[model samples]
Target: MIELSREKLLLLYRQMLSIRLFEDRVYQLFLLGMVPSTLHQYQGQEAVAVGVCAVLNRDDFITSTHRPHGHAIAKGVPMKRIAAELFGKVTGCCRAKGGSMHIGDYSVGMLPAIAIVGSGIPIANGVALAFKLRKTKQVVVSFFGDGATNNGSFHEALNMGAIYNLPVIYVCENNFYGASTHISKVMKLENIADRASAYGIPGVVVDGMDVLEVYRVASEAVNRAREGEGPTLIECKTYRYSGHSRSDPANYRPKEEVEFWKSRDPIFQFKKKLLELDVLSEKEDNRIRSEVEKEIEEAINFAIESPLPSPEIALEDVYA
Candidate 1:
């Protein structure tokens, strides 16, 4: 087991809670028609984002997928900015241009999320190559789903990363479904990590529901990349509490399966462990919860009160 300081543990818990609350609030707002554009939430997979990002420096970069709120939050993007972007405000990180799927801040080292599956893999490699040529220790992480692994880009990118020994980490968040299709039906291999062998790089699989386990594995991979040991593919076996998008009811999943995964909720499990270790008291946990809730509420209010982007500037940032 990795021994984390109380402060680090608390930070982890707070980040995870923020993601849960943020996603929940976004869903509510979407239902009320307060939020524009569709949402791909990141509720059950908070641990995967927080754990991996916790080990990265501010200079290290991360490429996100459509479900990028958790990644942006974990990488230190201000909640208010993200909320404003979802509201399509001028104060948004992308100035209302990217919307939900493209939310990101280059200042924080997160690329505007790519809604295209498997596309971020090569982009991450390109960034890693620059880092290598510049002799910088900066690393890049590519976040993608199980479906992306089957894409030709995934294979081509991994092959290049392996041969060049670039400082990148390919993270596959396998939630057992590729936009509602079960993995069993599509994948012949039992584990996605096994695909790493074809590219000759280290591949690790971890329990994504356990934040500490993920942190431990991610820490090792990050350290390896920083030292120029080449790319590592870390497959996080996680789940999404919501459907593929705002419109998906996720009725295809069995009730028992959903309940089972919910029972092993990352935030709940981590809180329990913290309590057992005396790292957090019941009173402290309650205080943290209240504080996070208040923060999120304030962020929502900020987004609501912010002004929308003017139509005149719509063509300013466009590249034809």
Candidate 2:
């Protein structure tokens, strides 16, 4: 077990809570038609993002999938800019162009998220290649869902990453369902990590709902990559509490499964652990919760007050 100081543990807790609350608020905003497009909220899968990112350096790169808000937040992109992007305001990370799916800030080492399934895999591989060629110690992480494992890009990227010993981490957030289809209907392998052997890379499975466990696994993978030992494939067994997208009701999943996952909600479990460790008191917990609530409220207000990109500017940033 990686022993973290109380402050570091609290930081992780805050991040997980922020993601949960942010998604919750975004859901409300989507319902009120405040968000310009359909959203793929990361409600229950907070631990995977928080854990992986918490171990990364500020210079490390991360490629995110369509469901990117939690990744963006955990990777240290300013929450206000993310909220602004969601609201289609000019002050967003992508200047209101990318919106929910593509929210990212390269200045913070985050790539503008790739909304296409499995596209980020090669992109992350390419980035890791660049880092290797440049002799930079920087590492890249590719975050994708279980559905992406089936994509050709996934296989090709992992193969190249392994052959070249690229400083990249392939993080598969296996949330049980690929959109609406269950993993059993698609994959024959009992574990996604089992596929790493074919590529000559180390593969490990971690509990996605437990932030500490995910962090422990990610720390080892990141260290290995930085040491030029090669890439590692980490499969996080998680679940998405909400629908695949705004249009999805997620009724395809059984109620019992959903409830079972909910009972293991990352924030609640981590918070309880913190209290047991005597690192967080009930009063401190309440204060932290209130502070996060205030931050989200302020972020929403900032987004609402920011101006939208002018109609004339739509043609301004177009590629030649």
Candidate 3:
């Protein structure tokens, strides 16, 4: 509706569908104890990552959190590699070293996803700093949670980003809770993006459930950063239907709250919007979903059959 091309819209919808299906598959696999590590599923916030990545160039970057399957796929990391990494295979993106929390493919410009909350902020700032020093138009997109906004790293990163006019987009995916603690109880600010004023930068709030809305807002921020207009704080108001971790009982929240957000599922909403726009027929939608399902199954098979990392290799990257 905002002059977006049909091709771009279909691509956006595909990315959103990929994330939704991938995350759902990951959740099911994790519940069966097939995965060795903990998972912070990005089930509900697919729109934020997909939308932000849509407007990015191949040379641009993104930082991810523990809930990073969506970010990885959006950034163009192959599912086979992500699945292999989760299985600790040598063919993984990180050679099975990074696992679920740290899956990233830097060759395409996705820096190693920082799993520690708010830790990627400074690293992304440094990447932007390098680009700015070189006078290139590259921009780094940093993704963090609401709890991260309360971290010292978040404050420090924003301060430095402001002072240096770094080419970076700070995307705060506020999925309400910071590992079970609601944003309402933690910060006094009504909108996390409003905190951008403390550093004298533009701040914005967008509906994270709506992919196009996120893309529109993020396009502005990415362009501004590339043009040396400095960084902007974009707080994506989203909700994660899953628990904080696959292990958590999610006792901190109410069932009604979970259901409320679930009803507004990003994947369903995106498909509906696409249908309304006449961009896809019901048969075409089902086919797309079926394709994703087949790919996921193949990835699972590949991961299961892949060779595990050598025991000697465990000591290989530890020091060097």
Candidate 4:
């Protein structure tokens, strides 16, 4: 449905593979007490971020939610810096300040990812407002989860972004469950994207498992914003493979539901589609997985050996 080059698709595979390994490692390390902070793993939600980010220019920006590793890699943040940030090292992208939840670099066009739910939406407006006021063609994409839709900041931001006709893309990765609550129980509307119509804006429901499907839909939204067409609200139908956080035992979800989602794993599904299209071979996919594993291992070693930020910096990065 979209014109994705073989090289770019390969790159997407690399990005997803990279994210999977990193998050998997983080999960393991968390269990081992290697990480000081908890994590909201972005395992199953990779396709949405990568697919959406592929349509964005480097000059454009993105705001990330608690689950930001996928978005960071998709946007070209190097593994070394990301791992270093996770280690709270001076070499980190944030200079060891914004650890896990705050790993972002404005220089890279990513506002330090806001961990608070729906908190980044209004900030996204300010970023887009700056672009619009300066008459720049840049667009800003704000990535959040379904829970964010229920936050008051969500409504306030949508209204503000719409009123000013800001160049923004409000992307909600509706993975069925919000922190543990099912969307059907929390949201009255059948489709979250459908709510965009209320603000007189385009709302799109996308297949988040298919990278190309997400890319095609997001491309239109991104292009529309860049062309001064204002913001769009996109709801991606996806599922998380793990619990809300590291301590979660995942007892809230059913075994069948988890198995069903696993059966449709984004990586396997996309690999199948790529192979069917003669875009990728199983051999290449396996090799890519090997490479990704190696990269993550090296990143972990780098983080382990890197020195932690000075204790004094704890107070420095808090406000300044």
> What TM-scores do the predictions have?
0.98, 0.98, 0.97, 0.96
- Where does model 1 exceed 4 Å of error? none
Model 3: per-residue lDDT, tens digit, 1-320?
Answer: 46799889888888888888888887788778877878888888999999999889989988888888889999889999998888889988999889999999998778778888999999999999999999989999999998999999999999999999999999999999988788889888889998999999999999998998999999999989989999999999999878898878889998898888888888788788889989988999888889989988998889889998888887777775
**lDDT by residue for model 1 over 1-320, one digit each (tens)?**
79889999999999999999989988899899999889999999999999999998999999999999999999999999999999999999999999999989999999999999999999999999999999889999999999999999999999999999999999999999899899998999989999999999999998999899889988888888889999999999999999999889999999999999999999999999999999999999999999999999999999999998889988897775
lDDT of 4 at 202: 91
TM-score: model 2 vs. ground truth = 0.98
Model 2 lDDT, residue 114, Cα: 96
Clashing residue pairs in candidate 2 (N, C-alpha, C atoms within 3 angstroms): none
With candidate 2 superimposed using the best TM-score fit, by how many Å does residue 40's alpha carbon deviate from the native?
0.2
Considering summed lDDT, which 10 consecutive residues are worst modelled in model 4?
311-320
Candidate topping lDDT: 2
What lDDT does each candidate get? 0.94, 0.95, 0.90, 0.88
- As for candidate 4, its clashing pairs are none
Q: Model 1: which residue pairs collide?
A: none
lDDT of 2 by residue, 1-320 (tens): 57999899999999999999988998998899888889999999999999999999989999999999999999999999999999999999999889899988998889999999999999999999999999889999999999999999999999999999999999999998998999999999989999999999999999999999999999999999999999999999999998899999989999999999999999999999999999999999999999999999999999999999897777777886
If both were scored by TM-score, which would come out higher, candidate 1 or candidate 3?
1
